[model samples]
Target: MTVPAFSLRNAVRASAPLAGALLLVGCVTGSDIEGLHRHVGDVEKRVDALAKQSSSKEEVAKLNENLGKQVATLLRSNADLGAKFDELTRELQTLAGKLEDANRRLAQLSQQLAETQARLAAAAPPDAAALPTSEATPGTAPPVAPAPAVASAPPRGGAPSPADLYAQATADYQRGQFELAREGFEDYVERYGRTDLSDDAQYWAGESLLAQKKPREAIAAFEKLFKTWPESDKAPAAHLKKGVAHLDLGEKAQAIVQLQFVVHEYPSSDEAKSARQRLKALGSDSR
Candidate 1:
């Protein structure tokens, strides 16, 4: 029979802050014990005995069986402590893996964003002042063309430009106004779908639904984002969030599939770290 899943909340609490440092200490301790077990060398055997004093109470108890009851009890107590340390070491290694994955993703995101910015800068319109000047005849000014008539006047209450719409949507999201944010983001996506920020607008529209606890709607929104912008920079994040939405709806199987896809396809992404954590919480083997 399968073992019951461990409580993620409890695990998080036990890990606290110093978990990573402890992993290194545990690795050293385990390695020393291993070398002695294998009879690697005299020096290693000496290190192993010392390390084992603090790392394995069972060994101490067996070796000092002829000692007094007090010594036996102390040795047993140390063994129990060692067991707990071993468990903590395993948990710390898992956390370290997740942290390393997250850092790699952040670096990739920074690089991708920098490249996007560079492309945008390179594509920016030339300054009007850089336009070539035409020489006028000595006695006359250059002929000027009449400005084109406005096709339509600006609305009495000026409609928000694309940038204004995006800012308003982001502010609404930050303020926890999920419904308003959803509407604003949807509007932005609909009106400016060809703009650079459209993918971001689409992604946040799903996030707003998620914030409102509408996981079904959020899933649909995320699906639409993927369908509409398959090549979007936000695609991996959208997949990750979609998996979370599935979890919120208690669709464990679908959640696993979506999260696994992120892990395999975007292994170096921050979203993949989150996906892996969720998979761990769900007792799914990401490997």
Candidate 2:
């Protein structure tokens, strides 16, 4: 039987060059057609691969954009944390300053208390009853004419009554008898609280309290003098003493207040000068 002839019209139109060669060679072989078909399939695969590569590039660019945003966010968060840390450090510094001020005031108060206690101890007098009597008398015997009636002890110097008492107290105070001096000064105040010397007595009383380590009591005494004799010469000194007592009591604000009053209210007074010096030592005075 005869084999049917393959159609060449459609096959030649698909590849003109190949069809021309085939016509020239008198016919196209199966191996040649298969090679051309395989070549066309490879070109299609290369085009598809290029398209996939372009898509991957676009995806990579999007990932990069997302990473940049994340980095920016992290930077902003770090800046905020840094600010918070600075604020906390400043607060700690402020608290430390306040504590230092408090401690300074406490130390001042303690010193004042000790001084007052020492003064009080030195002022006490010996008991009179403990001394031996120089003479004795029998009951109902007229005391043998009373030993010729001895004269009374004369007052020292020609000073005023209050001045005499003050002098005696001053002597005892100079001798380191703080308790005796304190009693004498108190007695003078009781007898002359309305007199010109009363202010002086009050001032000495406060000093005696301070020397006896009773700073709280000394402060009270000084305060009384200030309030009762605000226009007196002792006012400035009283305020100064009050400041010292307040310092001893660990009241820095209160002590500063009193010291400032002495410096400002009595700027020309000697006490004001002393207050200024003290304030400078404490690092509290600016002017």
Candidate 3:
């Protein structure tokens, strides 16, 4: 019985030595464990650096995208502004052109007005006896009427009548001697203001004033003809001349009204033709 107990104890002791040998064989080397720890630390450092670099790159890319968007918006805004500036410049150029044209027309009108006033002050009145007389026929006899009982007197050459003087004045006017013609015409009108030639004299007198560049006096003469002889053949012409006088005075609205009346009332007359031409020049030929 004692031998059986020793055998169990010895079997347990032999198992303990076997277990210690296996432990020694399976244990890690010191150098290998240290190398593994160093490798793990390097990996941790590399991961941290990689994460920081990746975050920086993402931030830079986002900033670049935002900058690109801002630059694009600025370019678009600049283009829009440039387009508006171009439109405004064109509009200003058009307006300037219009103003220049208006100024030129105004200057022309002023020059015309000044010239028209200079001729009015130099006109003169006419002399009746200075008019030419027709020679007597060879067969015409001398006057034989009995003289009054006082002192005997011989008959003198008969002076030309107002009609003959007016004829001479018209001939002078046609020959371009407007100053002399204007005097004669005015004399005829004054001497024969109640005669049938009064209206004709008045009209020709105004025409002479116009030929002399006396638009104000011409206007007065024409207005007198129109008012005094509304039914005369010269009425339309008088109104036409009056319109021209208004134009000389820079009265465009009044000139247009009078010219329109001429065109409307005397459509078939030469005066109407002149009025239409004037209306076209004034840019008011809508009719």
Best by lDDT: 1
Error of 3 at 271 (Å): 2.0
- Candidate 3's residue-wise lDDT over 180-262, tens digit each? 87888888777778877788788878878877888889889888888888899878878887887776666666677898999
- Candidate 2 lDDT over residue span 127-240, tens digit each: 334222432211101101112234445456653466567767777776767788778788878876897678777777787787787889988888778787877776776788
Clashing pairs in model 3? none
Global Cα lDDT for candidate 3: 0.70
Which residue ranges in model 2 land beyond 4 Å of their true spot? Answer: 1-161
Please tell me which model should have the higher TM-score, number 1 or number 3.
1
- What is the C-alpha local distance difference test score of candidate 1? 0.71
Ranking by lDDT: 1, 3, 2
Q: Report the Cα lDDT for residue 119, model 3.
A: 37
TM-score of model 3 vs. true structure: 0.43
Say which prediction, candidate 1 or candidate 2, comes out ahead on TM-score.
1
Model 3 spans > 4 angstroms off: 1-159
- The positional error of residue 43 in candidate 1, measured at the CA in angstroms, is 99
Global lDDT for candidate 2?
A: 0.68
- Candidate-wise lDDT, in order: 0.71, 0.68, 0.70
